[model samples]
Target: MKYRFALNNDIPNLVRLINNAYRNNIDKSWTNETQYVSGSRITQDQLFEELNKPGFLLMVIEGPDTRSKQLIACIGITFYETYAEIGTFCIDPSFQQAGIGKTLLGRAEQFLQIYNSNIKAINMYVLNVREELIQYYERRGYKKTGLIEDYPLDANLGMPLLDLNLIEMQKTLI
Candidate 1:
């Protein structure tokens, strides 16, 4: 597999991959959010806007072979003054539980630290109900900050099936 920055042409595939990983009921994974949320995870237009942002990056893991390379996982990072925010992280359901997500996350952290010398920590938020996801990150050294952000109901990303809040987690780079 190859880890690389997403290109403009990658938006469509990225959109499908993200939505499936997050909202598809047929292919449920531990990370699936369909139980707590409904609707598309991301739209192409929104991704385009984010892609053009100055301090943002979307990384993907493509694989099998060069001739038929397919995106199996992705993560986005937004650089800040002293830290970076990780978001839109997903892996194709078939690829989960195979150590791919772990590797991709580690690489993303390493990439940010190498790409920007100023980043001292990495932050990400998980839905408060996603205990499995929260614990997964905790195992990787992220700590819950006890900061909760209200879920944006008007964001068009999805409609929450339950009252939800985003729980902030952070990992300080050493």
Candidate 2:
């Protein structure tokens, strides 16, 4: 098991991992209604643009399967001076319940620690409607910050739902 930052060429697998984690997985917090209504798709071009942005880190976990290549998990981070935002943190559903998601969260936290000396917090915004997801994060030591906001309608997130509220979760690294 090797852990490394993603390369420019890994965007395709990264996108697949994320989309599968939620929009496609049966046990995922995101249901068919959510994926269907949202049109959940991200193109390689968009991923490239996102990757080139400042303070964005894309990390992937890979290992050999007997028959083929596989993407086990991934996490993306957008860092700021005082804090960092975590997005698209997911493990393949096939790899779920195997501690891959926990490992990815640890990596995300480690990445955040590199920027701010105090590393006041690692933050994320999850769909407010995804109760199971929120509970998952809570179990991982992230507490609700009571900050809820809507996803941008024109944010190029494949497709947008009519109304979406995301609740913020924060974990203090120090």
In model 2, where is the ten-residue run with the lowest total lDDT? 28-37
Q: Lowest lDDT 10-mer window, candidate 1?
A: 24-33
**Cα lDDT tens digits for candidate 1, 1-174:** 888999989999899889989988455676788888988888999999999999999999997665766888999999999999999999999888899999999999999889988899999999999898999999999999989999987778899999999999999997
Over 1-174, each residue of candidate 2 has an lDDT whose tens digit, in order, gives 556777878877777876666567655433223442465646678788889998888777785472344677777888887788888777777767777778878877876787567557889988776787889889989999999887755766645555667799999887
Off by over 4 Å in 1: 25-27
**What does the lDDT come to for candidate 2?**
0.73
Best by lDDT: 1
TM-score for all models, in order of appearance: 0.96, 0.85
